[model samples]
Target: MNLTDATLILLLAERIHGTDEGVREAAKSVVKKIPRGKRDLIYNVINSPSPLELVRHVAQNLDT
Candidate 1:
């Protein structure tokens, strides 16, 4: 993924922590603008996040 998208996904992945206000706000802002087809990645990251898993999902979505 490109830098902007990668950055957005990384912040969104931080949502798994729940208590990080900055990350949550940044993620919320970007996630709302994410295309409908790719919203599931946000759910996956929040539910079962890992750096590798986030990268994998982001890369997979980039490919689409």
Candidate 2:
């Protein structure tokens, strides 16, 4: 995925957990590119499941 989408995913992951400083920084780098209205969407996508589940979900989507 592109940097914007990747950043969103990283943000989502970081929000779910307190670790992953690198991912958080990456998310910060692209945070401005994300639209304000879409914050909830990113949160929802990230918080919908556990991190492992989220990883699997992303992997599944990418497989298609």
Candidate 3:
């Protein structure tokens, strides 16, 4: 399945806090690679009480 960059980042965030050490590290690596602009979007998406509709849609479908 193809996921947008934002969706992939959100999924990585979920994995970062997961029990698997290797997966967490890999997720962190990818997260760190996210550019500054995208990082802002990520922060907003994670912290906002009401993020944009598209972000919300992607977040809802993310596999936790």
Candidate 4:
């Protein structure tokens, strides 16, 4: 897995797992860096059952 991608996913996880209000604002800022078409995909992974899934999902998508 790309460390950069994994790090992004991990950081996103940290943000979301914090206070809801901060995450709401932060998510808007963070998601903006991603392409519009892929924003939901990132959000989905962030809310996924496990953090590792985000890493796997990011690695898979990044490889494509």
Distance from true location, Cα of 24 in model 4, Å: 0.9
- Listed per model in order, the count of residue pairs whose N, CA or C atoms clash below 3 Å is 0, 0, 0, 0
User: Candidate 4, TM-score vs. the true structure?
Assistant: 0.37
lDDT of each: 0.52, 0.51, 0.48, 0.52
Off by over 4 Å in 2: 1-4, 7-19, 41-64
Tell me how far the alpha carbon of residue 59 in candidate 1 is from the true structure, in angstroms, after superposition.
12
Q: What is the lDDT of residue 58 in candidate 2?
A: 54
* Candidate 1 per-residue lDDT over residues 1-64, each given as its tens digit: 3336835556455555434444444455565577766666554544453544454455568647
TM-score of 2: 0.37
Give per-residue CA lDDT, model 2, range 20-41, as digits (tens): 4444444445545667765553
Off by over 4 Å in 4: 1-17, 41-64
Candidate 3: TM-score? 0.32
lDDT (Cα, tens digit) per residue for candidate 4, span 1-64: 3334434645565555644434344444566576656567546545655545454455567657
Please rank every candidate by TM-score, starting with the best: 1, 4, 2, 3
lDDT of 4 at 57: 54
lDDT of 3 by residue, 1-64 (tens): 1125645655555445443343333334544566655555455454454334435465686576
